[model samples]
Target chain A: MDRTEQERLITENRRKRELRYIATFVLMAVIFAVIVVLNINTGSVKISVPEIFRVIFLRQGDKVKYDIIWSIRLPRIAMAAILGGALSLSGFLLQTFFSNPITGPFILGISSGAKMCVALSLIYYIQRFGHSSSVIMILAAFVGALLSTGFVLLLSRKIRNMSILLVGGIMVSYICSAVTDFIVTFADDSNIVNLHGWSLGSFAGSTWTDFYTALAIIGVCAVVTFLAAKPISAFQLGENYAQSMGVNIRLFRVMLILLSSVLSATVTAYAGPISFVGIAVPHLVKRSLNTAKPIIVIPATFLGGAVFCMFCDLIARTAFSPTEMNISTVTSIFGAPVVIAMILKRNGGVKQ
Target chain B: MSEYVSASGLTVGYNGRPLIRDIALSIRRGEIVTLIGPNGSGKSTILKTLTRHLAAIGGTVTIDSEDLSGITYKELAKKMAVLLTDRTRPELMTCRDVVAMGRYPYTGSLGLLTEEDQKLISDAMVMVNVLELSDRDFQNLSDGQRQRVLLARAICQEPQVIVLDEPTSFLDIRYKIELFGILKKMAIERNTTVIMSLHEIDLAEKISDKILCVKGDHIEHFGTPEEIFSTGLIGTLYDISPKAFNPLLGSVEMPAPSGEPHTFVISACGSGIPVFRALQKAGKPFAAGILYENDVDWQVAFSLAAEVVTEKPFEEISDEAMRRARELIDACEEVILCPVPVGSVNARLRELINYARNAKPCREA
Candidate 1:
């Protein structure tokens, strides 16, 4: 092709990709608005839509309605959106780190590892040492995440095939869960009532302080990850290209693991272990945007994860109304199908 | 030309142990240097070490008179670019994005491409003829297109020197020629020094100003392609029989059909090459003769024929050569004459052709 023709072709293609990115972002924003309104309005009180808005913006309305919206639903929604975004972003980072498409905290047993540590601290440490703060739990979870990540990395050196390595991760998840179950089964009865539902996973009953702590951690880590988009983009081309492009691969890798660990640990500390959001949300966001330029996909994935978890959290609360489903159960119901479809579509693409 | 990159005692291997030792090479600015050796003979090890992807066990590499190890990675990246055989399947990255990554060293901390960086990326893609693929998904491209895209990425780095390991491994003949053309242009017009490993000896011989033959424990030979090709060096480097390589042709051939002569072929010029191969494929030993030694047919005849009657290059077909040809024709079961033009010096081959017609018919069943 001639120079002008080539230039025109490139500009046109870029325009189309830009259009897709805008459309995807607009769609995410629209979903965020809809889910935020639905989560507040539909929670059994049947408060009029205007009253819900008045309670939120003007701090006016029925006293009971004001109390419920401000204390219960708002914190729950905030936790769902923020922690969900964190989980998906964590998954995206882990996938990039491992160079495997199916990789995520949930799929690779990282969340379960965090859960095991959280459960251990709650059952053993908190029982004897009195109640602990969110930061302490996050620390325990972070350490547990690093330990499992180390095991997976060591196993990765021995097993090059991804399916087998994933099986290895599943084994780790099972072992961790079994130990957590044993601990829960034998723990004190008074705490079990509170702990069983939390360990089973839920976004409900989160306090404002817990939300703020998670917000502080996830918010800061997310910005750092977004800024690291350049290195992440280079990393997608594999380590050699990233290194050749002046990325310090050893330092970059350490940062990726730590950042992903922090994000997943924050989620586990507050909301317990959630499944499939990490893998499914990022996959869906990338497919919708039709690009994985970390610059665009980082925020797009966060928005997508927020939308996804809010929808899942809504169902977890109201799917049986007054009898809440575990957040994992609700997430697995929605997210696992996306994961399955992704794997099948990927395999089919390879065949074609 | 001034020396652009030089390495001495560049010991290299895996895990701090030397696989190939005591290497010394100096490459001139604006020169294309290629490393040629058998697989697993340390060609890639040398390249990886030079590129710093694999650490060298000993010695130093100097580029523009600065020690490679002394330079910071960020600074070194500005001076050198590399295209490795890394199987990268980046998710949803455009071909443009892949190529634009070459500007990493020049871009700001966030790697956002400046207007100038964008122009360089476009120029590099256009250079390698991948301009139209700018927005196409990188993972969806064919191996040849990906190789060209990667070359564009390297070119956009604007490095003084480029290092590639087996860049043409996945390319078809068209892309292979195109890659060489781009490298040649880079070396001449742009004055960028090129160092790479190539498995194609024919291509290596034609394209390289300097050739490094890597094998065994040390550097086997290092010189211009002419010097390297003349010494029958490639066969030793690859551990093949010397006869397997035709240095004059800059290509290799299989071991010739052995045993007694089955067919007597009368041919000259370039006509006998196909006939020689046909006989060899049929598992029939053949005798060819009565041609001037300087004829192109002499090479194939000597390589394939069980017995060859010939004269030296530029020499007349002597009477003694004709007698030997007649004897071989009598021994052979059949004779096939390739269409070769008869001239004053090779007029004796016409006599042998006549004798084959009159003699007892011994055509193979």
Candidate 2:
């Protein structure tokens, strides 16, 4: 009402927002630490915390325990965290681009498209050279992701309604999945064994090389996305408003599509096509932070996605023990309900 | 002030195709211009081109004597702000957060608002009287409050020109008045030129310094509100019956009831509007009489009455008007006398009332 009151109210709101950001980030960090330790501690070979620390930090432990920690569990955990963060960040970018929370690499068939291409390349490279390199797989997945993104963007141009665009994405997802299945069904026995596991979506068999490659690609993308937070924030208001605020809409859109595709492509290349982590993690992080300001939501979503996927990965490994469930199964079990709740809330709130 | 914004032979539309062409406009600094047209008449297309949301199909626009297309978007952002018709449902954003976005052109790469930016944000919010709502979630605010917050967002941009596309579409009458009051103050005090399209021509007539009539493939008319409204161009612009719109009063009335007159009403001095409306609503054709041309009652009667016997302002009722009134009273089945003052200049209305009482079944309204 008055000048002093108005200033006080705004300052209070800002302070409250700061507190929310701090709390959400801190909670995510704590959960991330716990999940990392749990992922290390509760594998098939029971390694104690002290021994896990010695193997990780002191680099002196029994040969078998050290090998499991350094070679197997650590890379898998790092891959899950990095890929999870990348997947969620990719989803956040897509949601910002589409202005719809329901959209993500998975929902828009981007991940499925990557999966289809990776499947084809896997069979082709394995048949020709007896093995598929991670670089080749990533390149193939990136192309496939871009192809799917291009189709979605084309459909989005003709269909202004988000629901219709989503339906179109689902159709694309189905078509790509059918193609991947067709490839997998006729592959060599050894290729089928590999392609079937990858197609089902898992974070297993991730090596330090895979981890470092994902880290390099996703790390660059995350920094670029963070730097572009200003435009992304403007974009949340809608395309016209963003353009009015000095954002080159054409360039900004290209950047969004490329970044989102690359991030999702990296995840799909390494982890296969994981579902719902992209959509669900960003939604949860924004709801927890109580804001969608990209500067805050970007890093927070990455952290939140890391925690979510690491925890899901731990469960996938330990839930059934030896008979490891696909990471997608765990992520879907936890992530799908959040997406459903979000949809219900959106529908009810829009009605009001 | 000189022309702050000028467009000559500008053509605007979507996808390289032109919808409206050859629009020439020159507006001074601190002026408010409004575009009025029917639905899908290219009002938004013209505004979009000016805001650079859409590329111009032809011609050029200049701001402060600089070719509009020559300026970078960032430089243009400092000079122009827009409030579009698109509904933005930003998630988890407070009204203050939404308003703070206006400082995008001024803020650093990360868009952290400095203290001065904060002050301007507060000032803008205070200017629009949304300071109290600064803490409310933007998506939860009512339409009126959302529009004000968005106006606050535009104001904080500190632009030389503010372009809005139908900014008052979702607002009610009270919010409409408040929003325009803020725009007028900004135009006068801050020297911010305001360009917006409006569906409400009455408000546009009252608020705008210049009115651009958009229709068909070109600007139908562009001039001061006096020049535009005085010539009854709004009726032709919207394609409504000329009699339905009263240019003098800047209000519209429903079509008059059809068929022969069944009732005659005698009233003046703003007393006969209610009676005329009642007869019109009952779908009975009515004749109203002996009112001066400049009277408020005459405006309503002209629009809603089947026939009206009128006299010039501030004169005695002429014999010709009285004769016409008498003839109307004779033809009607009944006559109603509204409470009118007995002024000496127009006291002949007492004779008409007496004549009507003697000739027909008369009643007081």
Candidate 3:
């Protein structure tokens, strides 16, 4: 074809890509809004949509509805959205680090590592001081996350095969969970009550303080990750190409590991090892966007994760009415299938 | 012209030990320099060191009078682009997206392509004849198409120098020619320096302005293709029988049947090559006669025939050569006559054919 025609075709493709991005983002935003409203309106108190809005925006509803909106449901919604975005972004970074789509923070045992550390610290601090601070939990989780991430990195060095690395990560996850379960089993009765609720993964009891802390951590990390879109995009081509493109591979790799660790650690500290959101959200978002360009995928993934988790959280809260399911249960139900389907599709594509 | 890319006393290897040491190179802008060597001969190690994928073990490389060690990777990227042999299986990326990645060094912080960047990307795709595949997914392209797209990516970087490691490894003959043709055009038109490693010595001889023959722990020979190809250095470089490779035609032939001649072939004008090969494959050693040194048949016969009686170019068969041919026909068990025109220059071949017919059982090939 002629040059003009070629240019026209390229321009048309770009336009189509942009349209897809805009449409996907719009759809995600609409879904996010719907989930937010649903989460706020569908709790045990049975607040109406208008009453929920009044309590949230106008601040002039029944005292009980206002308290529920401000004190409980709103904080829970914010925590779920922020932590969910954090978890998914963490997964995306890990996928980029390993150059494998199926590997994520959860699959790599990072969340469980954080869970183990948080469990250890919760038992120690609550036993010694009667109550533990969120800061201590986050710090402990960060240490645990880094420890697990460090182990995974070492394994990755020794094992270049991605499947084996994933298997190794799963083994690490199992070890960390076994240790956490051993500790939880022997902890005091009161501590068990607190740890049991947190260990199973729930957005319940998320205070405004927890929401603000997660927002601060994840917001900073998300912006830093967004700023790093160029390198991450280059990295999708793999290390050699990324280096040729001027990315300092060693430094960029360290940054990816550290950033992902922090993000997953924060999520684990808040919501106790939510499963599959990391692996599933980024994959689904990239599929929907029809491009893996990090400049678009990063934000779209964050929003997609928010929508997915908020929807999952809504179910976790109201699925059995008075008896809430764990957030992990809800996420696994929706997200695990996506992961399995992705693996099957990948295998099919490879066979073809 | 002053050398644009020069390396001296360069020692390169993995870890801290040396694989190839004390290598020296001087290449001007627009020169296509190729490293030709056998497998595991440190060609890739040298290329990787030059591209800064591996740190130089010792010594230095300078580009445009600036020390390579002094240049940061980002600065180096602006000057030198490389196409590695690694297969990049980027997910969900279209051909255009892959080519656009060449703009990494030039694009802004967020890597949004400007109109000029897009234009350059498309122009690169056009240069490599992959523009038509602009919308296709990169992973779905054939190996040849992928190589071309990757070359376009390197070209789109618009670097002063391009380094590629075995860029033609997976390409078939047609794509190989096309790839080198594009490289040559890029070098001549844009004055971009091309440095790469190639396994095909024939193509390397034809395309490279400078051929760096790598072997052992150092550069065995580094000079123009004429200097390298004429010295019979390729045979020793690849550890093959010197007779197996024809430096003139840049072709390799299997070793000639290793025995005394059992068949005498009477042929001229390029007709004897297939008969010689068939006899060689059947393990029947043969002797060929009355070929001018300049004849195309002589190229193959010189490499594959057990013995060839030759006359000088532009000369008819001498009496002495004909005597030797008759003696050979007398010794052979059979005579195979390949079709040849009875031209005035080679009329003497007809006499040998007739003589062979009488002395031994003759068969037409």
TM-score of every model?
A: 0.96, 0.97, 0.97
**What shift in Å separates residue B5 of candidate 2 from its native position after superposition?**
1.8
The order of the candidates by DockQ, greatest first, is: 2, 3, 1
**Interface RMS deviation of candidate 3:** 0.9
Residue-wise lDDT of candidate 1 within B1-365, one digit each (tens)?
Answer: 78889999889999887898888989888989999998888998988887778878998888889988787778888988999998889988889999999998888877888778878999999899999888889999999899999999999999889999999988998889899999899989889999999988888999999999988677889999999888868778888877677777765777778889988877777888888888888888888877566777777676777777878776667878878888888888888877868777667767777888787463421
True contacts kept of each: 0.61, 0.85, 0.80
- Candidate 2 chain B lowest-lDDT run of ten: B243-252
lDDT of 3 at A142: 98
RMSD of 2: 1.8
What TM-score does candidate 1 reach?
A: 0.96
> Which pairs, if any, clash in model 2?
none
Higher-scoring candidate on DockQ, 1 or 3: 3
- What TM-score does structure 2 among the candidates reach? 0.97
Regions of model 2 farther than 4 Å from truth:
none
For every model shown, the clashing-pair count is 1, 0, 0
* B241-269 per-residue lDDT for model 2 (tens digits): 88887877888799999998999988887
Q: What does the lDDT read for residue B55 in candidate 1?
A: 79
Number of the predicted model whose DockQ against the real structure is largest: 2
TM-score of chain B of each: 0.96, 0.97, 0.96
Global lDDT of model 2: 0.92
lDDT, residue A97, model 3: 92
